[model samples]
Target: MLRPGPVEQTATATAVSVGHLHQVFRDAYGCGPARAFELIRLARAALALQRNHLSLAEVAAEFGFSSPYHLSRRFAATYRTPPGAFRRTQPAADAMWPVRQAGLLPLAHLLP
Candidate 1:
């Protein structure tokens, strides 16, 4: 038996019927499935950047990004700042949750 990953299954299902699947994802998430997935990935990446000492390359690899540059570009586009800047601005020992910057939340439409 072969099992497909989330991405594989999404791709396969979309290939079969893109309009229906796209609408379904949009209705559920207020965005297309691919965009929703991207938001989720970037959110996790931001969390990892704050909590881990991993290099951008390592984080990209761990998150299945093709390369550090790809990750940086996407991260910058989503967060409105590069990952290095986000990481550099972290407090010495943050007891509170990381503050969210603009352009980072795709589901903000669901919020107010």
Candidate 2:
């Protein structure tokens, strides 16, 4: 048997149905749990790019992405730039501060 994924586990832990969990996430974060998780993952990947010298494949593997190409696709879709370009241009100190300081709710903030 397969173990429950994070959203399902969260619903169980919180004593709510998965549907209710999704609803609550949507109400609080303007997106469902899956999307929130994705955003959090992407944000972390971006930070890794800024603060490390890991190759794209290493970064992708560390962050649970299937491959460097997959990471690039998602990163480009979200940030409008590829991971290599982001690493080259972004200052480590400013990796995510601007977005957070601008009042965008970081998905990780919703976690314990």
- Estimated TM-score for each candidate: 0.66, 0.79
Candidate 1 global lDDT? 0.63
Q: List the residue pairs that clash in candidate 2.
A: none
Best by lDDT: 2
Cα displacement (angstroms), candidate 1, residue 19, comes to: 1.8
lDDT agreement with native, every candidate: 0.63, 0.72
For model 1 the TM-score comes to 0.66
Candidate 1 collision pairs: none
Candidate 2 has its poorest 10 consecutive residues by lDDT at 97-106
Per-residue alpha-carbon lDDT of model 1 for 1-112, expressed as tens digits? 1111365476675585666777876676567666665565666667788888999988887766778898899888866679888888843423111223323244433422
